[model samples]
Target: MKKFFYILLVFTVLSSCSEYQKVLKSEDIATKFKMGEELYNEGKFAKANRLFAQIVPNYRGKPQAEKLMYLYSNSFYEMGDYYVAGYQFERFASSYPNSEKQEEASFLSAKSYSMLSPAYTKDQKQTVEAIEKLQTFINVFPESKYVADANTLVQELDFKLENKAYSIAKQYNLISDYEASIKSFNNFIFDFPGSSLREKALFYRLDSAYKLAMNSVERKKEARLNQAKEFYESFKKAYVNSEFISQADDMAVELNGALENYSTKS
Candidate 1:
């Protein structure tokens, strides 16, 4: 009985494969469309994508084009081909403005771009583009069910940009390029005032200023020390209980000791 059941299942699988191959090679668009949709519904997106691609241009401007294009665009998305999926879904949304699936297509198109965003350490062109796409989707579909998700993606991408900027500034500090580090951190603070990293930025900026002052020549040391003192005060005012408060106090002790010499000279 077990052997019989196994043979029956094997036969069924072979028959299905045979039929799929026959339909794939056949020149009949209707048959291809039927099989493609069946495969799509059964979660066989790869096979469905092949059949849909063959018939897509032929069905253009036809009554079934809208449905066919939607299926085609989604098959790419299902297969993780985000670049093509993004473009195709954008095309589908533009082509069928009144489609019941139009909103879904637009949202998915934006989502596909988001999926293509690389890590924060890499070049951030795609990250910026994804944020723009998601922002546009939110503006266009203010009441969409997907708006919240789109906003979340935008926030995530925005943070990636913020992280990249912050890292570059921190890198400058690590290399002992205190002047460049101070400039970069200043730009970062101004650009992303609401960044989650703002606290770190403020601390690091003060650290850079303090280091630069401590290393300056005798002629420039007094003025740079005064500037560093101002940075220390600003950081303390913003975050009295910061994690770096101990280190900050240590730096302040050295700064005050140096400033006292200048004060005595007056």
Candidate 2:
């Protein structure tokens, strides 16, 4: 009985494949469209995608165009070809503004870009793009059912961008590029004021200033030391109970001592 059932299933699958091949090669657009939708509903996205591709051009300007394009873009998304899906969905959004699927297509287009965003260690161009796209979706469809999900995606992408910027600024400090590190960290703090990394960025900025003062030429030491002291004051004011408070205070003692020494000399 088991063997008989297995054979029957194989026969069924083979018969379906045969008919699908015939559909693929058929000149009739209507047949192709129907088969493509059926394949899509069956989760046979690759096959559905092929069928849709063949008839897409013919359906343009026809009543079926909008839905066909949406299904085509979604087929690529379901198959994990998100780069192509993002472009295709974006095209659908612009081409079919009156479509009932407009909000969904717009959201999916942004979500597809989010899929392309890499780890925080990588270049963040895609991450930035994802944030922008998701924000645009929110702005356009304020009450959309997908608004919450889109907002969540934007938050995640924003954090990734913040992490990348923080890492780059920290790297500058590690490489003894104190001047650049100070500038980078300052800019980072200004750009991402609400970032969880703000405390660390502030501490690092002052630390970098301290290091710069220590390494400065005799003519520049006093000025750099004064700048470091100002940075220490800012850190103390903002992060009074921070994990870095003790270390920052130690740096401050050294900065003030150095400043006093310079004062006595001048």
Candidate 3:
């Protein structure tokens, strides 16, 4: 009985495919639209897209154009071709500015771009684009139901950028490039004033300055040590009870002792 049922199912599928192929090659536009909508409703988006793509130009400026364009764009999204989905949805929204589907189309367009955001360690061009698109969506649709989701994606992308910058700065410290590390951390602090990594950035900046001072020539040593001492003081004031306080205190003592020894030698 099961074998009989399996054979019946296979036959039905083949029959449907045969009819679908016939529709694909037919010159009957209305039949194609109907079959495409049915295929889409059945989650057969690739086949539906093929049908829709054929008739879309023929139906342009007709009563069904807007709906056809929306479905066509969504087919790309459903297929996970996000770049094409983003472009197609953006086109639909612009082509039908007052469409009832406009808000959804715009949101999906930005969401598609967000899907293209690569890892935090990669080049951030797509991440920047995603943030800009999400921000634009929020500004245009302040009360949108998708606002919270859009905001979350923006925050995630922003943190990715922050982490990328922070990692690059920290790499300089790891490689003993004290001068570049100090400059990078300073720029990081200025750029991401509210970063959760601010304390760490400050700590590393102080460490870099100290290392740079210790390695400098006698004439430059005093000036660099003074700068390192200032960094230590600032860090202490900002993080009085921090876990790093003890380590920072040790660095301070080293800076002061070095300065005194240098002065004695002079």
Candidate 4:
């Protein structure tokens, strides 16, 4: 009985494949459309996409074009071809400005770009682009049900940019390029004032300043030490109980001691 059931299943699968091939090659546009939509509804997006691609141009000016375009664009989205999905959805929105699906299409288009964002450690051009797209969606659809999700994606992408900037600044410090590290951190503080990484930035900036001051030549030592002392004061004022407070305190002691030596020489 099980063997008969298995044979029947195999036969049904082969019959379906044969029919699908026939429909795919049949020059019947209506048949293609009907089969494409059925396949799409069944979550067979890849197969649906092939049929839609063949008939898309033929249905351009027809009343069914809008529905067909939506399905076609979403098929790419479902298949994770985000680049094409983004472009196609954008086109769909532009073409069907009055579509009931306009808001959804716009949101999905922006989301598709967001999906293309690379890791924070990589080049951030796509991340920037995604942020712009998401922001536009939020601004245009302030009352949309998708606004909350769009805002979340924007925040995530924003953090990616911030993290990338913070990492570059920290990398400069790691390479002992204290001047560049200080400059980068200063820029980061100015650019992302509300960043969660602000605390780390402040601590590292102080660390960089301390190292730079302590390593200066005799002629510049006193002035650099004074500047480093000021950085310590700034960091401590902001974070009295910071994780780096102990190291910061040790640096402050060295800075103050160095300054006292300068004062005694006067």
Question: How accurate locally, in lDDT, is each candidate?
Answer: 0.96, 0.94, 0.94, 0.96
- Pairs in clash, predicted candidate 3: none
Write candidate 2's Cα lDDT for 54-117 as tens digits: 9999999998898899999999999999999999999999999989998999999999999999
List, residue by residue over 151-195, the lDDT tens digit for candidate 4.
999999999999999999999999999999999999999999999
- Tens digits of per-residue lDDT for model 3 on 33-121? 99999999999999999999999989989999999999999999999999999999999999999999999999999999999999989
Off by over 4 Å in 3: 262-266
Error of 1 at 166 (Å): 0.9
The 10 consecutive residues of candidate 2 with the worst lDDT sum are 257-266
Residue 5 local lDDT, model 1: 100
Error of 2 at 13 (Å): 1.7
Better of 3 and 4 by TM-score: 4
Q: Higher lDDT: candidate 1 or 2?
A: 1
The TM-score leader among the candidates is: 4
The alpha-carbon lDDT assigned to residue 69 of candidate 1 equals 98
Q: Which stretches of candidate 4 lie over 4 Å from their true place?
A: none
Per-candidate TM vs. native?
A: 0.97, 0.95, 0.94, 0.98
